[model samples]
Target chain A: MNGYLLAGTITGVVVGLVIAAVAMTFTKKNRKEKFTYDERQKTARGEGYKYAFFTLVIYNAAYGIIDMSLTKPWTENMTGMMIGVCLAILVHVVYCIWHECYFSMNEEPVKVLAFFGIISVINVIIAVIQGLHGELIENGMLTNNCANLIVAVMFGVILFALAVKGYVKKEAAEEEE
Target chain B: MKNLKLKAARAAMDLSQQELAGRVGVSRQTINAIEKGDYNPTINLCIAICRVLGKTLDELFWEE
Candidate 1:
C-alpha cells in the first residue's frame, strides 16, 4: 500500500510537470500573440476559485460528519488529499468555463457550458469507478489514473478543435458578407 | 444568415482585421471571426465597429 501511494505521488508529479512544460512551450512559441488575462479575467478566475474552495470545505465537513457517525476509521490525510484533488479539478473546470464565457467575446456560453458539463460527467464517472474498486492510492494516484489523464487531455483537444472549427466557419461567412 | 457588410466595409477601407479590431477595442481574432461570420458581436460591439468604419447598423448587419 505504501509503495502504491509513493508510486501514485510520483506519477502525479510527473504528469503535472509535463503539463507545465507544454504550457510553457506554447506560451514561449506564441510570444507575439500572447494570451492576456485582464482585470475582468482575473476577477472571474478568482471568483471561480472561491466557489470551488467553499464547496470543497462544505463537502469535507459533511463527509467528516458522516464518517464519524458511521465510526469508520478514516485518516485525516486520506480525506484531505481526496478532497484537495477534487477541489483542484473543480477549480480548473470553473476557471475554464468562466474564462471561455466572459473573457472570450467570440465564445458562446451554451457551448462552453456543454463542454464543461460533459467533462464533469466523465470525471465523476471515473471517480465513482475508482471509489467502487478502492483503486485510489494514498499518494493521489488510482488504478485508472491513466484513463483520467487521457480523458482530461482529450477534453482539452476536443474543445480546441471545436473552437477552431467555429472560428473558421465564422471567418468564411464574414468574407462572403 | 446575418450579413457581415460591416466587416466587408471595414475591409474595403484598406484596413486590416487587426487594425480594425484595435480601433474597435477588440482582439484581432474577434475581428477575424466577425469578418468570417463565425461570431455575432453584441449590439454595442456592432455599433462600435460600424462607427469605426463610418457605417450604420442597418447597413452592416441586415438579416436575409
Candidate 2:
C-alpha cells in the first residue's frame, strides 16, 4: 500500500464526513422553516467567504511555491493538492462554526445530503463499472483515491451556490418589488 | 445598536424571540439579529416582523 495515497484519501474523506456530521447536527427538522437566511447570517456568511477565499488564495500560492521549491518531482507530495484543498474547506468550516451561523447557512441540509448522497451512489456505480473493466485500479489499492475529494468539490459548489443565493435574496426581492 | 423599541414591543406583547421567529416563520437567530440591529431585515421581512409584533413598519423599523 502506498502511504501517500492512503494518507491523501483518508484526509479528504475524514474531513468531508466531519463537515457533513457538523452540518447535520445543526438541522432543525421540526422548525419547518423554508429559508434560513436572516440579516446576521448573511453578513456572517459573506465575511466567512471573504476570509475563506483569501485564505485559499494564499494557501494555494504557498503550496505551489513550496512544492516546486521544496519537493523532488513536484508530484512527490500529492498532499500539495489534497491537503491544500482540505485545508481550504477546513478554514471555511471553522469560520462558519465559530460564528454560530453554520446551521443558518446550511438551511436545507436534507436537500444537500440527498443531492450528494445520490452523486455518491453514482460515483460508486461508476467505480464498480470501471473496476469491472479494470480501469479504476492504477497500481493496486491506492489509485483513483481522490474520489472523496471530487465529491467534496461538487458539494462545495452547490453550497457556494446556496450561499450566493442567500446573499442576494434581499436584492432580488427589492428588484422584484 | 440593538432595536430596543422592537424588543420592548416584543416584550410588551409577552413574546420571546423564538416565539416571534416561529410565528414569522423564520429562525430565532433572525429575530435575534433584528433586535440586535446587526442585520437589516428585508421590507418583506420587516413587514412580517411588524405583523407579528402588532406594529407598523415605521414603528419597528424606521429609526426616528
Candidate 3:
C-alpha cells in the first residue's frame, strides 16, 4: 500500500510500454509485414516453450518454499514473480537462439538485437539510479529495484548467447567452405 | 543416417543449401541439418524438398 511502490510500478509499466513501442516501430520499418517461422524453427521453438514452462514452474515452486520458510523474504512477491518470469524468458530465448529458431524468416535480427541492447542498458541505468538512491534494498531484503537488475542480466545473457552462437555459426560455415 | 541421396540430388541440380531452402520456404540451417542427419524433417517438408529438386520421395528419402 506504499505510495512510492505504486508509483514505481506505474513508472516501470510506462517505461516498458515505451520500449516495446520503439522496438515494434523498428521491426515494422525493417521486417516484412508477415512474420513467419519455418517448420523446423517452429518445432525447435515448441521445445523451447516446453523447457521455459518447466523452468518457470520449478522456479515458482522453489520460491514459494523459500519464502514460506523465511520470516522475511529477500524480495517482494511481485519482484520474486518477476524474477521467475525473467528466468523463463532467458531459458526460452537461449534455447531458441541456440537452435537457430529465435528469429523468424522475415524478422531482422539486427533490429531485435538492438532492442534487447537498448532494454538492457535502460534497465541497468534504472537499477543504478535506484541503488544510488538507497532504494535497491530495504531492511536487508532486496526491493523491486533488484528486479530491474535481474531483467538487465537476463537480456545481457541473451545478447551474449546470440553473439556467441552467431560467431560459431560463421566459423562453422567458413570451415565447411 | 545422413540424407546423402537428397544432397546428391541437390548437388546434381547445382543448388546450394540456401537456394534449395529458399525455394522450399525454409531456412538454410534446416536444409543443412537435414543433409547432415541432425534433423528429420516432416513429410510436408520432405515433399517440398523433393518437389523442388524434381525427385520423388523414394529417390531422396528412401533408405535401403
Top lDDT model: 3
The residue pairs that clash in candidate 2, if any, are none
Which 10 successive residues of model 1 chain A have the least lDDT summed? Answer: A98-107
Better of 1 and 2 by lDDT: 2
Q: Report the error of model 1 at residue A41, Å.
A: 2.1
C-alpha RMSD between model 1 and the true structure: 8.9
- Candidate 3 lDDT over A65-139, as tens digits, reads 999999988887788889899899999999999999988777678889988998899889988898999988899
The candidate that wins on DockQ is 3
Candidate 2 residue lDDT tens string, A51-105: 8788779988987786679534343244346556656666676566555466663
Against the true structure, what is model 2's DockQ?
A: 0.34
Could you tell me which 10 consecutive residues in candidate 3 chain A have the lowest summed lDDT?
A: A25-34
TM-score of 3: 0.91
For candidate 2, write residues B1-64 as lDDT tens digits.
7898899999999998888987886677677767877777778888888888789988887788
Candidate 3 chain B weakest lDDT stretch, 10 residues = B21-30
lDDT of 1 by residue, A1-177 (tens): 588767876786697588556544443423345445433344556777777777777777876786678554444454445555565555555454534323343333454546445664675677667767665554443343434544554455545645665686578668866
